[model samples]
Target chain A: MFLHLFIVNKSGGLIHHRSLSSKAPKLGTNEWLRIGSTFHSLYAIANEASPVKLPGNKKNGADDGIEEIQADGMTLNCFQTRTGLKFVITAEPNTTAAVDLGQILREIYMLYTDCCLKDPFYELEMPIRCELFTQGVENLIQKYSRIR
Target chain B: MSRTPVNILDRPLGGRGSRAETQVSLSAFSYLYSELVQYHQNRVDSISELERRLESSGYDVGLKILELITYRNREYKREIRLMNILHFVSTQVWKAVFGKPADSLERSVENTDEFMIIDYEPLTSTFCSVPADFGQLSADGYMSGIVAGVLDGAGFSARVTAHSVALEEGEANNNNTNTSSSSGGAQSGNNGSLLPPRKEKAVFLVKFSPEVLERDAAMDR
Candidate 1:
């Protein structure tokens, strides 16, 4: 089951956070911000430490970064866009639908492009509080829950 | 440790991959645009205000897309000429947004500063239906903003407006007669008959600032 969702900007700031299940632990806004920055640093460190190198390049790696992490009976999956915006989702440890999570992340990205990026009222790198975005996310969560 | 600032031009086009051609579902876009319109409609008191909001939104998209498309075309240098920029907007930018080039690009015979970019079916207004009371509300204001953005980004300040010109059979004949008497008689005569039946057509009217024309003259000299 899905537990939480977090969107981190390239600057390691939390742009969006949503808790899917009521059973998920409640964290203060500051705590969530800390998690976002921590994860971003970890991602950078992982990319730096990886042994595999890109086919044509010596410095960059083909490892698309740390996509999934399992810890404390929970799993965290991250999907990063070409622009460096990251979407991280937390799910139960035994939840095996990695592909579905990726699809969800992509849909979220599309919503962000349209509702947030395209909006004149929305400032760049600001927390996404657009009503349309929230509605789209809720719809996606409902659809996924119904399928399960 | 000192780090050199990353130059955007020095980086690869798609960051990691060679050239990533990304696509969003049309239905998804339509829904989002509809919501955007509805949101603006509720807040604004006037039709022009609603259009202005839509235009500003499109402007932001246009500014980002100008950089992106220019970057994507690795051989593209900065466009300086008026005609070249218009061609870029009607062809490259239109294709990037709507998956096809504009139907036609025409220069106004009566006005030297005016140009028209025709789209047989503009994506932004395809699903939109203006109510009878809405009074000449063209959903293509967003597209106009995009055109304006492209022009402004290329150093040509311009005012772009969208007009729905889907004339009925009888009205087309009347328009043809009226145009035949005007300065652009031959061009209008051909345009009226060339369009297919029953399809919505939008014309983006672009009027460049006077300084742009002066610059063009100086460049020609």
Candidate 2:
């Protein structure tokens, strides 16, 4: 599946964007807005989403809910890393296909960590504010998506 | 002159005078800079003025670093030519303080006395959002001041200006962090630094005033 992406810094300024794969069909303007709006909604919901656990965390003295978002389904998933930076992933429906998509998203995150995050220009939470991360991910997605 | 036999480690190059190699914590420097910004805030009457004031502070640090570097390397033979001195300052002196040479240094072809030092991510500018109420103060002035102070002390009278130059598209972004700010953001400030994915890199332009060249020429006679 091809996913067109836009990265912006926390200031909401667009930093980088491109299609991830050749096979993934480009979503139209209406589709793109729908995805963004859905993603934003999901992100807010995800913050409240968690696995089963006690209401209060005694160990760290902080409340952390026990819930995991399944990687499956035709939906948008956004994950923010420890540094208050956000990551968004979208995939087609179902857990089976979504599982691979999830893995792919994780790989993309790792790729971002390795390539863009390591670049001095990539400021944290500033959107996919790093140019190098954008290029590296694009190449990887293109090279691997076709082969896979 | 304290005249105490300085540790051998202090001497970078084998020279007659002693050179001290002082290790400063990045946290300490950041805190100092923060305080300096606060101090400048008192002197300024407006919000943007505060940032301009802070930039001048960075410039002051730059100048001090340049001076200390020159003092540190006084034992080295005098660089006869403008280029020679610039290289020595940019590479040797700059590296000593900032831990790497500037990202680039260039002489202005249009003007004989103008030189530029480019820092991809200037330390003062990074991690700092100039708050409103400080007036037209920017960190750029501080960085420029440092360069100016260093050049002036080195017998090269010139103006150094620090402008924000972000390279949004370039391969140099990946490999150049080591020369930039690996140890730069360890702040003593409240907002803890997220570990740097890579270090910051900077380029400095050094220009020699015509007076400096003329003096060197006269010395040759």
Candidate 3:
């Protein structure tokens, strides 16, 4: 049921975006950039606005940001790591099965650490255009997302 | 590819070494460190420049080490807060590299963005005796560089510097006397200590960028 995946760097830059399904939103390149930066700021703001402040040090689950956005057709699930990397997936609300997206997101993160981080050519905060990383993500998203 | 000669790059950078605790002897390390310093001295014109070179070298190692350790860690433990990252550097990072954690982790009294990790008898400089020309230079610049690399890798951009905080013998004695009785000093003096009194100290100062401070503040408000 997963439709789209987005990777936002710590600086709020849209480093990677993939439409996992035909049902995913179609947008201009600039729009994705806007979405990444917008989500970045909003994540921080949401934390500040929250009545119960999450501890800053360790893993703060659901964090200070919006974890899910259940719209009419799309349900957006966000997983933000302690290092400020955010993984977002938009799924069909009816078919995504109320599953824990965080587990899959963590898996994707491990892929990132191994494929992109281990690559000497890869620089932090730069656009992730690594082939191995792309392949790794594809393998993960395919495995985790329910067959439509 | 199998026919090609195997070198450092070809070998597996596996996590097995950490488990095996493959430690290098202090004497061997001293020899390597002196050679590294001498190599940098020949390449750089100024002491600061030499230090920067050392820092950059350490930075390379720091980046990989931080990522490796975090990746190896099984728990969901990742540092988000400023204190958390600093604590990781002083304790976890230091312990991994130096076989011991830093002596103390302290926040700057005046500047909120600044923090310090004091390491008494830093591993890299244990046998290093700097030339008079490079007076007051701390050989632990590489150590500070590693700290900087780790912070930057973890999304906290910062500048880290290593300084020598070792006091003169007379002053050190006087200070020790003020804190403890003279009779107590004699016992400590001949207590068969491994390290001599008035040993040099390497203080690593980490000054984070303003943006980090702002972001952290915004998290609260």
Q: Write the per-residue lDDT of candidate 2 for residues B1-221, one digit (tens) a residue.
A: 67998686675543344322244445455445555665776687765566456545555565666555657656645456667667766677666655566666777788766777766655554434432332333444555666666666566776555554445545355434453344443332222212233233444445556788788678778
Off by over 4 Å in 1: A1-148, B1-21, B168-199
Please tell me which model should have the higher DockQ, number 2 or number 3: 2
Task: Report clash pairs, candidate 1.
Answer: none
lDDT of each: 0.75, 0.51, 0.72
| Tens digit of per-residue lDDT, candidate 3, span B106-162 | 988998888989866566664354544577777888888899999999899999999
Highest TM-score: give the candidate number: 2
Question: A14-91 in candidate 2: lDDT tens per residue?
Answer: 444455546456766456545545554544444456343356534322133211344453354444444433455544
Could you tell me the TM-score of candidate 2?
0.53
Candidate 3 global lDDT: 0.72
Listed models, DockQ each: 0.02, 0.04, 0.01
Angstrom error at residue A122, model 2: 11
- Location of the lowest summed lDDT over 10 successive residues in candidate 3 chain B: B179-188
lDDT of 1 by residue, B111-217 (tens): 99999998766767644546546777888899999999888988999999888886555533223233222212232234322222323578899999999999998
Ranking by DockQ: 2, 1, 3
| Superposition TM-score, candidate 3 onto the true structure | 0.49
